[model samples]
Target: MKNSKEWYKLDAFAKTYSSIISEGRTTCFRLSVLLSEEIDTDLLKKTALFLEQKYPFYNSELKKGIFWNYLQHKRNGFSVELENTYPCTDVKRENPLKIIYFRKKISLEIAHFLTDGIGASDFFIDLIEKYLEMKYFKREVNEREVGNNEETNNLKYKYEMEKSSKNEKISEYSDLYSKYMKRVNKEKTVKHAFHIPLKILEKGQYYVTTGEISIEDIKRESRKYNTTVGKYLLAVYFKILLDKYPQIKKQIVIGVPVDLRKIFSEKTYRNFFINITPSIDPSLGSYTLEEIIKYVNNYFKIKITKKEFYKSIYKAINPMRNIFIKSVPYLIKRIFFPFIFDYYGERGYTTGVSNLGILKLNRKYSKYIKGFRFLPPPSKRCKIKMGIISDESKVYLSFGNLTANHEIEKEYFTYLRRRGIKSKISTNY
Candidate 1:
């Protein structure tokens, strides 16, 4: 173990936010793939050794009670433990990677902070394919993407300006509203135990007429409905819910995570992002898909302007208890977060839909890979959570937190397939 050194300031902020909000148990996403070969235990060790050697940052620990501090400079990194814990420092004496290669299912759970929806897609796809090749092809394969260099110079604003915008104040969360905050504070946050099963997802080459769809296509379609692609997708999902859960009348709000980089010019490799801008909750018996699209599109178009972007950033960064909580220690932040949540209402959204838009990667895996799909973290709020991620060729629709909703997932794939597009659904369902 090493003594704590000062971490980048932004990293500290990210650590603060995540520690406060992350419940630990449901924060990670579990991915299951069926394997064809017998367990390659030695090769699994080799792969872990290869990763550690290739990316030294994977061995580092969090300091100042902040995970982001450990990751600020390392854009791509992960720490392997014999087990999981916050501020994990110990290194694995044995190979952390495991393989079942059973007739059933193989699986892996990924920490959300390690990668976003887009990044996870590449990693998962690459990992599966690499494992396959190692067993069958007997050849080493590299699927890592390169050159995610910061482009602050090309942006219009400075990081400080963005920081200032992020520091603005917003209306506080009412204690009456943030009831879950207390449970979160005193609750024993469950850290999920490791489980990589042998479930498999079938793969195939998919092509679409809209594979060549450019920004112009997105913009044109958006205008056709007077909405962004995000709003359009929200409308589609909302319709699916209506079709499935016709009896439920609660507000159907979809959480949309807005990337601050779209507005700010900060290039720091930390999670300085916020999930704001919910779609208009469709009325119980009244709203049609087109109507929901209109309402959501108009609302997003109005709310996500430069002014709203900065305002939302400010609300997330500038703590309501800043002056008072300032006297509170960093360690206390993790313990007493429910007090804050009780005030803030746990980010007023029901389901999450993050659009990393299109995934961009280097020449690696270009020839072998067809596309990508983003599966959102399973929600305690909703039974079925959906996300869409695309490459140049196809739109991959994925659902998470769904224990056995393959029928519903199949319906979505069928809907897209009927639209004259190439599609596939991947899940244990």
Candidate 2:
């Protein structure tokens, strides 16, 4: 163990989670930011230095697989095996941190294994804001929030805040629960990789808005309905799908990712999560909006819990002991993974949902960032991904993909509008 080079931040979740032979590629996103104020080069450098010191991973290596080890073992960023993974280190910090002066806007490309849009967005804003404040106001920054700030509510305080429902237990398993076990064992290579370019649209240009649902209102509605905020939105989409394509609702499957934080008390920096509990729309062909919402709610309730979450982790970790014992050659482990892991994500979900809850900008850049947006990776398998976020006052729903066809997505929005929830839809096709 002498040359182990163990750093506390070495993400065990990313390490262990990546061991499974599925979508070996990590989740990644790019952020483009425009500052309202002038940039401070010196302060920016100081900020990067502070981030490096504070989050030791900034100085690490990605030598081991994206999950195994990092290039700079203690660097403050994602782990990637450079030669193997294309666009591996999207957020290139090779140039001097002072390069902030040369660029008007910077794009931060990050792997999802490290942080979701909300998490990465939080860190990105914090780093820049802290740098500015340190240079101008000479104030210190505290990375981790404690005390009242420790409450998950304050996690994104600058935008808006609302209280979550008290924990509630279900008496019976939901009716929507399916009898089949969901696993990604099949692989199919897509003829063309799905790539969608982000289009920067003028705010409030694309859609008309009517009634607005506030953050408090959404949370309250979710609790009142005995469902989750995510499920509430899904309920909205399900109704949309049912109404728009009334003849096509034969057991439609909608997928939502379950954040493990709700189940585990442990804190780690990695993409360790699970998809929504799968259930068929038994009455899809004949169900009404209210019925669909209720079904989605009940199903979401049964699938998520500390017990089930742990069970998922357990199953993922100790895979095929009987077969793995034969020990595929090391060369096979390296070569066979890409084909196997990718096949897993394809067969894993009929559709995908990534809900990065309310995104509130830090106080430091409160004047700089007007609103936030998140678009997930669009693939042929999961042609559409719904990203939902709340700005304390209103919730934003968006449909993302590389395909230019607007009929499907437009239908989705039209359905939402019909449901009394007002929203703006933007597309970068």
Candidate 3:
């Protein structure tokens, strides 16, 4: 109800998204959690409202400034929707973020401007926690508070207590991408990678195919190669692509997003990860899975270093920090930025795979939760975007596709199945 919120510019990672967002190319992602039973819609609605106060950035809207763009906050109310369409569709600028609940799941479909997968999960987890607290734990405490005139106070106390646990740095709105940015020598450019030429799905359609497999299985397989699970998976991914396009000469580049928070003591949730392109150049000749893994791991080892990583991060942070780029009026920047982004950004990679790592839920709330899934947003050039999240037992691999074909996803899982990693596939076809 108040406009006391301060003004801020869009984070560096959001510049491309902001420009292309208007062309109906809003880069978006979905974080979903399943519950033990059907969701209590009424209570989930209240939980969404409460979580908003805790994460006010979700309510932000983009406004064009003369030189750049400004993100203005408006405490506009949002209503949860029933899950009907495929997950991770393009969210319009007007309603850049939304919460939709299915029977046993609540999915947050948010624009890239909102936050990264990790940031989204923070809010999604809180929403689930608050809802469960109200449904079970708070009810457990309700009998105590009902005996006095402190009912309202008790509720507010719970709100404040939970809210207080969160680090206040979340509200600071500092651009972590820019904050940790280091100037580097000539920023290297990415050449065009092998693009999946699958038939595009109908305009209103998006395909999400999930493969649920045991984390232990993945670990066992990965260790056999002396590589981590992510690198191992990329090896298999490259192998699959190489097999499918045996004759293609281009590199099979996948955008593997790195969490800068690991090195930089940053807390802003706006958007702060950089994609490291780990690729397989088919021209190098045929290679086995182990060879592919070795190649992928080598790329990863080199990229993680401070010098190598900043070179990549500098490319993204430079535009936002560049005086010329910032001074070129939003109108002109918007016109050329999208073209540059699609050509330079997404064009650099064939597809993207982001691993959000394992999620360990609180014991108190574990019974109320089922599992979690991460769906990465697809790009114009990259037909399929993938995400991986693991709970204690299983790893969930979701492919958000724009194509009618399931060949790539099917083959990826098929490779895992051959390795004795059984995968139960599900899709929103």
State the lDDT of candidate 2 residue by residue for 259-306, as single tens digits.
664564433233445665354443425666567678776766776775
Q: Distance (Å) between predicted and true CA of 287, model 3?
A: 1.2
Q: Which prediction has the highest TM-score against the true structure?
A: 3
Deviation of model 2 at 67, angstroms: 12
Instruction: Estimate the TM-score for candidate 2.
Output: 0.63
Candidates' RMSD to native = 12.0, 11.3, 4.3
Best by lDDT: 3
Candidate 3, residues 86-130: lDDT per residue as tens digits? 666657665778889988888888888767877777777777777
As for TM-score, the candidate ahead, 1 or 3, is 3
Error of 2 at 169 (Å): 28
Q: What does candidate 1's lDDT look like per residue over 176-265, in tens digits? A: 111111112111111221111223222111111112223444445556776766566667666765666655534555666665445544
Instruction: Arrange candidates, best TM-score first.
Output: 3, 2, 1
Which residue window of length 10 is worst by lDDT in model 2?
Answer: 171-180
After superposition, candidate 2 runs with Cα above 4 Å error = 1-26, 30-45, 64-108, 115-122, 128-228, 242-251, 282-284, 320-326, 329-331, 360-365, 425-429
Q: Give the winner by lDDT: 1 or 3.
A: 3
